[model samples]
Target chain A: MSDQQQYLIIASHLREAIQSGELQPGDKLPSEARLSQQFMSSRGTVRHALEKLRAEGLISSHQGRRSQVLLPALTQDFDSVVSFSQRCQEAGKTPGERIHSREMIDAGPRLAVQLQCSSSASVLALVRVRLMDNTPTMVERIYFPEEIASHLSDYQSSSGSMYQHLVERGVEISHAHSTVTATAADADEAQALGVAPNSPLFVVNQCVYTADGQPVWCSEQHYLPELASFSINNVKERPSPSFFTPGRA
Target chain B: MSDQQQYLIIASHLREAIQSGELQPGDKLPSEARLSQQFMSSRGTVRHALEKLRAEGLISSHQGRRSQVLLPALTQDFDSVVSFSQRCQEAGKTPGERIHSREMIDAGPRLAVQLQCSSSASVLALVRVRLMDNTPTMVERIYFPEEIASHLSDYQSSSGSMYQHLVERGVEISHAHSTVTATAADADEAQALGVAPNSPLFVVNQCVYTADGQPVWCSEQHYLPELASFSINNVKERPSPSFFTPGRA
Candidate 1:
């Protein structure tokens, strides 16, 4: 095999080991010399493989410590629009949804501003509880303009994906940013999710947009914290040089 | 003022009221009709101004409720490499650091792996609690290679930004992605931040990167939840035409 191809083989094997739970979180890896010998590759090649894993968030390093494995790869793609069904499927779990409420209401001062319409206009509010592996995981309250909701009401609520429904109706789902916080499960959330009040919950406040940057949907999702942890990858910028310090830029 | 700037003027004025606490979080805003009459602009212009504010996270909308104002503005710059000092500065808060530990130590397996170095090599571990407006807000643990730390040791534990220190030594401090979760505050964190043990705290897991995409630093920041909430803005993809499929990619 080519030298470069061999490194990929090495990386894939390690990745599989991680995926299979053979190497647990916080587990240490052997030295580069030992890994090179074991993989039957040059030291540089082994290093290359390790670097790839590190970049993928599978491993971390320190100067004097053995390389340690990160916890099971529980990462969410920040750039993509991920549906509950898609997320559950990726984890090999079953996804189910039950609609709690669907109503068309007059836009009050608050929602009128959000939909960018007059208070007299109407909006459709849909609330649902999502289940993963038969256990309730999240409660979502979504609001859409009447135009969008009219196109979605006839769809099956039990298994239909609103995102997909909107998309089919030619509504472009571009991107969303969310503000997340931890909150005590209120009585309503606890009852819906089958969890006790005061249980730790993840409250995600989200605004979804269209490619043209129109606010298409807004929702608040409350998740049971122990169900899963959220993850994000970041790219940092170098600190401003002295020459580029304030007043000089 | 230019006609195109009218909306901006009204938005900025409302933003100041929200930021200065003239309008508090959860407080209702005057209706759009009222706002248009007050601002002497078209209702569409007023509505546009409100949408801008909502998009910036200074306000929130609910269908049947009043448009509630949010707390003082948070500089939610997800794209930028945000440091405690930088964040505090942006919020007009005085930032200070009290270093608790700064020493070279044996790298553990996990630390070694993250740094991609030999386990026997020394690494610098720095621990600090940061203050905003003289209130302890977060605890940060950082690790660096020995060579990098040595160059920074001259700066007293209480002085110097680690990112700045690294920059001075030609080490790049690029960007970071962070995962935020709500965890029960431990005893140590409770005392340090003067909160009760088991209080909800935001655990931010982050990795700082270099220009070449090298993972240089990993840290876990614990925040007092009452102090803030997290926020992100995202765009959704065009949903697939079929909404019933569970795993259609």
Candidate 2:
């Protein structure tokens, strides 16, 4: 087999070992040298395999030692475009949502800029509380531009994935930009999420764009910090003298 | 000049206007068509210029209307590799630090894995609170491997930037991995940041690496959410069957 395929095969074997309890949580993986010997793959390939598992949070790698199998972890990776419900399913959890309210409203000045639509435009607004394993976890206040909102009338259930539903209806999602911050839960948010007032919530301001660069929707989601967090891996680039605002990001 | 150059020049002019108070906050920018006509550029180019300003938080853009200049904002962009102190100076804010303590400690099993070092290896530990404008904003618990830690002794001051100090000392810094989560402030963190215990804080778990993939240091930073937050721009890629944990990022 080719090097790429060999590495994937090795990763698959390890994944199966973890899933089947062959290598239980807290078990140290075989040393890289032994894995390289057994698979007849170069150490680079072996390391590549390990990195993939690390990205999945299935294996924890510390330098100069064997990696350890981790307990099933629920960590969000902003790098992927997977829908929220699908992700919960992947982690063996049931996902549900309650539509607290929905309405067609005129885009106010603030929402107009956020959705990149004309001021006074008609927009669809949705307020939803998403639950994982029946526990409230996130409160999403989402707005959809008129054109995109029209497609959702038929597939508007919260148990399924809105991202997938839109995709099925031919919404070619191109990208998303998100700003993550923290906020103290207000009375309404606190009640909805079963948290005390002034408890911390992760505020994610996000905009979704179509493939042609049209803004499709915008969402302000408040997430419970206790359950989920964002994992980002950044590589240094050539110095660009770009001055950023203080530790905001 | 090329189209790229044209856009940048336009951005610079707009930037100058804002800084010079020619375009005051709450004032509307000229329409894209007018800007294009004035600059002898395409509407696309003018929009690109506007996008640049939006990224800097200097302007807010809504479709079918003029953009508005914005008040100065303090936000962080994780995409840049600039040092914290430098960023503060760029924003015209004073950055300071108070080093609580420093010591050499053995890398226990937990820390060893975190620093990616051999267990029982000598490690350096530093605890400090980073300040902006005389207000304590973040508490950083930092750990460095022996090699990198040794270089830190000479330049260990709270007033200067450790990132710059390391670079000046010939450390070829690479990229970083960060997991942004939320936590309720403990007594110690609350006392350090002058906030009530159980107030929400942003927990940034980060590890910096070298060019050759060596781990340089690991830090657990607690940020007062009122002062700073992370802004991220994500572009969607080809659909991968990858599953992520729920809304972590």
TM-score of chain B of each: 0.61, 0.66
**Residue range A49-114, candidate 1, lDDT tens digits:** 675555455666454456677544433442223466666776688778888898888878887776
A-chain TM-score of every model: 0.63, 0.66
What's the TM-score of every candidate structure?
A: 0.59, 0.66
DockQ, per model, reads 0.13, 0.21
Point to the candidate with the largest lDDT: 2
Which tens-of-lDDT digit does each residue in B164-234 have in candidate 2?
78888999765566678788888988999999999999777877766555677888888898676665443
Alpha-carbon interface RMSD of model 2? 8.8
Off by over 4 Å in 2: A1-82, A158-160, A238-244, A247-249, B1-82, B238-244, B247-249
- The residue-by-residue lDDT of candidate 1 on B129-165, one tens digit each, is 7787778887777887676666776775343356666
Model 2 scores a C-alpha lDDT of 0.71
